[model samples]
Target: MADLKQGSASHQHEAAAVIQKHFRRYQAQKRYKQQQSATSTIQQHASRFLARRQAARDNEQEQRAARFQAVMSRHHERIQQLELEKRAIKQLGAGELEAWQARREAAATTIQAHWRGSRQRQQLKLSHPALATLRPVACSSPQPADEPSCSTRPISSKVPSNHPLLHSVTAAGVTGLHAEPSTASVAAWPAHRAGLEQQPSSASVCSGVGYSSRAAAMHGALRGEASSCLSAEASRLSAVGAAAQQPADAPRRTAALPAARRMVLERQVQLRTDAFKAAPNALAAARATQQESDQRLVHLLEQHTAAAAERLKAAQRRQKLLQDAEALHSQLQQLPQLSQLPDNVTGAHFALPGACGARAQRSRQAHALALAEAKVGSKWWLPLKALNQQLRDAAAAAEQDAGSTSGSASKAAAGALWGAAGSTGLLQQDWQQQELMWKDSWQRIREEEQQRPGLQELMQQDQALRPHVVIEQELSSESSWHAASMQ
Candidate 1:
């Protein structure tokens, strides 16, 4: 009985163990299933969240793209309009091109002068030594009208006192003139020496010959000899004069030295005159060259002027065109967000803005603006074209404004015109308030128009609507569909 009980207990214990094991296994499986269910729910929720997030992101991007497209479209349209304006502006204002050319020529002329000055300086250096020697002595020495005032000069300290007559004429004044030479005689010696120096001594000797027969022959020879001797004596007298004028302590002149010094002075003067006459042909040629240069300069200036005028005109035309383009772009900016606009609404109701005073075709403006506005949606945005147009328009408008109130007459006219236009609104009032801002500037446009009927015609052809016109359209779009006008 004990064994059986024990066996039953063992069996119960084993069965209990088996049931416990099975329960444990079942609990583990149920736990695992619950874990999987929880994991799946988490994954599903995460997926839903991800999908919603992606959708939201996509919508945001789409909105951004739409706005970008509209901006880009506006830009492209503005570019095209500006391009048209640029073409028209290029056609107007003939003087602007001339002015530009003149500026270029002036610049070239300035450069040429700089180079010429540099070349002249270089030449001055090279010729300085020769010029120094040839330059006339300053008349610093006080003159005494009587006695042919020979200024006492310092003989060139360069020549040794022992030097021969071949020394510089300037340094050794007529050291050989008269026994008690007056100052006037010394001054006159240089001019007189210049005339007599080259003459043969035979002429002076012949002038003193005697005229008897048998005694005449002998007398003639003797007279000739005596005349030679007298000439020699005269030459000696000039030397004595030169020596006398020297400082009291200086050495006395030898009799023969005077004649030699006189000969030297005479030779020096002859050389100067010869030099003066030597270059007639060169002077004539230089005059001819200068004349030719003058003619060339005149011709070149005329060509430069004409070319400059043409360039100025083109620039003015471009400015006008840009003004029109700016006006158009500004108008585009004023337009309501296309994304906010209903698809049912056509772009035609929008007014086209111009940088100039002229109006463009509404249909064309619509397409251009719409296309520009649409480009913003694309991945790549090209703002260059639009920005360029904007810049051009602003420039043109500035020019026009400057012209309108630059002068007293212009200011008066502008005031009258504004009064006639009548500031009816806040915006017009704002413009009027700002009109005084540019009161002093003279605009080429108005000046041209006022002075020349042809210019006015050209301006009419080139000018477009004001850049502010675009804002007018946007501000009025709610109540009225504003159309840009050509008038």
Candidate 2:
């Protein structure tokens, strides 16, 4: 019985040892499993963090690329606009210069025509027949009273005769000789008449011897009177006799004396009178012509001055525009390159704020917005809102794509899909379509708003309604509409 009890205890001990060994092995396996689970969790977390970081980096790179592209496009557009402006400026300047030259030529032609007309009128006046006839006579001839005396003298008797018939015959012959008219007679007739009146007349001559001496004295006195009166007549007759002797030498002078002298004096007076009358008329005509020409010249000068001023203003404006374009180009050239800019700069700096701000800032924005609306109209907001919505949609779509991806293979597939979408220009096409739609909507809105009542109408209404105390219902309604539209 002692041997059986000892063997049973030994068997119990072996079973206990086997159970302990099994328990230790089970504890070691539990520890190894826990460690493996912790390692796997850590690795998963690391992979997820790496994916998020890579996505963030890709988003930043895309944003930088988009900004660079936008800047380049804006620069290109500005250059094209500047080139167009320069071409327009050059065309305008050339046109203005040509117009100015044409105007100057026209003015010169007008002035030349005026001068030519004046000169022609003066030449016509100088060439007048009446003036030509009067000119030489007035310049070459002496006064009628200062004419040259004739060369002949009257004869007187040495002894006196006492016969009444002879004395009467002699007196009648002497009076007849003086009565013959001539150029000298016309000049000296008045002096001779005065001298005859001053001399005493002889009563009668006696036929006896004692009357011979008295008759001789009376004959002498009568002879003196006859000599004074007939001097010019006798000389003229002697000249006629001499001209008859030498008719060939002075035939024209002798022939012209009888008819031409009287006619020449009369013609001279008439021509002088006519010329005097015509001179005033010609002078007045010339003065009127000059006045008209001066007025025309003044008007032309005024027009030219106005045109020059307008051209000058246009040139100045073009110069200012060119300067502005050059300045913009220089500024663009001075800017830093996109690749050289800092990478860590927050893209939020480029984002514009909406309505949320401090009170002052909000008021300022509201004021700016109102001004923009007044200038550009209500259509400006449409494109802005559409762009913002498109951006939000793109972000949501990206997030959705990222969330849909699961393990490494799925994530890689999602990345490839995103790359494909970008490479295939799907997002760009959508963005372009959105922009086109926004532009179309903006254009439609702008056109519609332009057809509405403007500030000019409001100002007109204000002026017309100033005197009246009561406001019209139509005006009130329009004002409310305007206020609503502005809001």
List the candidate 2 regions with Cα displacement exceeding 4 Å.
1-256, 260-265, 336-487
lDDT (tens digit, per residue) of candidate 2 on 261-300: 3333333233333344445555566677879999999999
Error of 1 at 135 (Å): 4.9
Clash statistics: count for each candidate: 58, 0
lDDT of 1: 0.47
| Candidate whose TM-score is highest | 2
